[model samples]
Target: MSPPETDIAVRLSGVHLQFGKTRLRFDCAIGKGQIVAITGASGSGKSTLLNVIAGFETPDAGKVEILGDDVGGRDPAERPVSVIFQEHNLFAHLDVATNIGLGIDPALKLGVKEKAKIASALLRVGLDGFGKRLPPTLSGGERQRVALARALVRRKPILLLDEPFAALDPGLRAGMANLLLDLHRQEGHTILIVTHHPDDVRLLADSVLFLDGGHTLLHEPTAQFLDHSDISAVARFLGR
Candidate 1:
């Protein structure tokens, strides 16, 4: 029983990217509403693959499709995706609500409806009354909550998280992971998160995409990836 094309949230076929000495080639299809963890050695192009899908980096070749549409020609802003980075990427001076409002409208001309949406998003991320606080005043976890809130407001069908919880303490990271899982269940957004933590993958990802030497070494269900660390490369990477 083959799934329909519409069931694929993201597809990268024969995708290729190059930067100086580093060359990347990727091919994978992630199902709709699934959470996929992208893991690899530091320079294995994990983030770059996300960039290519988000339209931040143009691939040298191949198709980049989102929800059955070829979005390779679209700009980052035009893509049906929201990206959350490790830095949180919040404005130092902007209040939390305004930072999220920017996601709805870059000009920040947030209307009544937009304001309500922001409020709802804040609540969804467990930061309801903290909207007036500045980014610097919030703890690292709180700041990442703001980022997640912002992504929620965008209402994109796809979410790209580039090690967004990497800097958080283990407790905070686990909290964020649970929050993310809750949000995903509610929103049904297809998520691709780049992370180095096996626990993160174990906790959240339905599948794992393992990159090595600028190529996809493996892409399999989380159970297979975690249970069978017998594969030499994955074993070495997982330190099993």
Candidate 2:
């Protein structure tokens, strides 16, 4: 059964993208406040799907609705979404607080209230007193936390992540996943994660979207996707 529009946080319908001979299509509805993982082999278009939803890549044909509003033709910044990437995308010249403040206003004209929000975000990401540090001085994991803090300050309804934890070590990755889970519980932002790690899928996602050859092969509950699915491709991928 289709969920009511209000209950859906994101919907991609009849989405199509083509590059050379490769063609891609996606159709899925993500429930409100759900964390869904996009998983696939290399060149399977997992990141491309995230790009489409983030408005970084335009679909040749499709409708992208966020929180029940059609966002087709909208520019990236105009959309109510925040994106965090694997590299963290922090500016080398900016301090952590200034870097995070950019999420609220790119011009950096931050008032007291905005500065308080930055402090709160830093504390939420567990870097309260480190906001004055430069990105280069921070460890990889700490930098990623700064990226997450930046995302939190953006206060968007939807958060898109493209391998944001891929560069971290296993322990750090797990910690980040737990932090993300806690943030989701507190903020309730619908999250879509494009990840290559099955452990990530197991730890963070409520549902899984499996892609192959640029097409959505399955969108199922996390348990079904991991344990009881009969899909041969998934079995092969998981080495079951």
Lowest lDDT block of 10, candidate 1? 1-10
Ten-residue region with minimum lDDT total, candidate 2: 228-237
lDDT of 2: 0.92
Models, CA RMSD each: 1.3, 1.1
Give the alpha carbon lDDT tens digit for every residue of 141-173 in model 1: 999999999999998999999999989999999
Residue ranges of candidate 2 with Cα displaced over 4 Å: none
Which sections of candidate 1 miss by over 4 Å? 1-3
Clashing pairs in 2: none
Candidate 2 lDDT tens digits, 1-240:
346887999999999999999999999999999999999889999989888988999999989999888999899999999999998899999999999999999999999999999999999999989889999999999999999999999999999999998889999999999999999999999999999888898899999999988899989899989994477778877777
TM-score of each: 0.97, 0.97
